[model samples]
Target: MGHIIDISHHQDPTKMNYDKLSAQLDLVIVRTQYGSRVIDKHYKTHHREFQKRGIPTAAYAWVRGISLNDMKVEAIDFYQRTKEFNPTFWFLDVEEESMKDMRAGVSAYVRALRNCGAKKVGIYVGHHLYKKFNLNLNEVDAIWIPHYGKNNGQVTSQPSFPCDIHQYTDKGRLEGYSGYLDLNRLMGTKPLEFFTGKEVVKVDKKDEIKKDKPSDWAKEAWEWAKKEGFLDGTRPKEPVTREELAVVLQRLVKKLG
Candidate 1:
């Protein structure tokens, strides 16, 4: 697998070697803005450059709102500004405690993004605040947690929580840039398609029903099973799982008893 790096105004865009950088990257996450007020100056340039090289790109905005309204405003601004770039995912970077009730504020921000027609939204949280904020994890499509260990450009430790992506180090060095960079790795079972909006869920043939209706020979039995509440009357041609079989057997035994 290639590398995933995030860059902002700090990582001077002019000095970056696009050709070399594009060769080594699986994806690039560019900062769009810091809340609603301060936009990242180099965001557009970074997006254009990375996209020119056919590299997959995503965008993130640092959340800095103190109120629910502020969070919504920031979300709208972030989406409006970066939507033209067509980022694979829009991420909210929540680090500092900008609001007293972070859970409510962050939830508002995520909802705002959803209203803005963003199909894929993710959040990046400081590892330390993972348990402290207690934000609703189900609201977002993915979670990215940062736990830089040793900070020597190598991934020394992983985050303790379950996350979709992990930012292993902030001092990471790559050939395309002179300064340090934030490096991330895909964690758990999520594939790259999950982030890129190209995921094709594979269904097992055994799990799928061959036809909409049951075969003539089994139609009567299927109807009887459904009438008896032993089966759900769906997917008549599908193979039953062991658990389902056990449940049906138990129901039969109970009826006989």
Candidate 2:
């Protein structure tokens, strides 16, 4: 794919430059600072500079230690400030293992975000947290899965609760970024209007994905895709291999369409 990228302030300033990055990436997710005691502060320049860019952008918030009672307070403190960014998507970073009121906290954050006019409120969690929760994901609008398998393993393929994106690695180095940042793919959640109350527009190539994963299919389908050149085991970075993309698209056009 062309110009695929991710952004987070957690990188070393000595390593990454925002303006230089804006020149390359077509889409970037700028991490926002949390105005709370429990959250970590992100780079302010990252936020300012991403907004200045002409690219399609989204934002993420650190949603640690949130609760239902603090819905108003949390909503105001956490997400309200990000409204300045008319984000096409928003993500809640669920990297905690503390398990302190995790369910209520997650539900409240998701609900509050939905109520906040976000076109899509995304939940991001690593594979461990995901399996631990084993929570009925059908309730959540969409999922952002983070799996950095050196061998490049695919995550689960739930038919109903189809994931929206996959973070193939957390140790990615890119053009403008100075430190390791997430490298993700925009997976499918078609009829985006259902949850977002928006209209059906043409889907971007990254978004026109099928729910079929090699690990999710029958033994034959999986093999056929691979033999026919669909699911190649490769790590993701700023720019994906178009050759691989073409193979996946060819397979999906038949399997998905």
Best by TM-score: 1
Q: Write the per-residue lDDT of candidate 1 for residues 1-257, one digit (tens) a residue.
A: 78999999998888999999889988999999987889999999999998999888999999999999999999999999999999999999999999999999999999999999998899999898989999898989999999888978888988999999999988998998988999999999989877865557898775465566898999899899999999988878778899999999999999999
Per-residue error (Å), model 2, residue 146 = 0.5
C-alpha lDDT (0 to 100) for residue 151 of candidate 2? 26
Model 1 segments more than 4 A misplaced: 198-257
| Number of clashes found in candidate 1 | 0
Query: Against the true structure, what is each candidate's TM-score?
Result: 0.77, 0.60
Whole-model alpha-carbon lDDT for candidate 2: 0.60
Q: Model 1 Cα displacement at 251 (Å)?
A: 73
Provide the overall lDDT of each model, using Cα atoms, as 2-decimal numbers: 0.91, 0.60
lDDT for model 1 comes to 0.91
lDDT tens readout by residue for model 2, 156-224: 332233477666666666677656656666568543333223465676766434322333436576566
After TM-score superposition, the amount by which residue 241's alpha carbon in candidate 2 deviates from its true location, in angstroms, is: 42
- Which one is best on lDDT? 1
Worst 10 residues of 2 by lDDT: 151-160
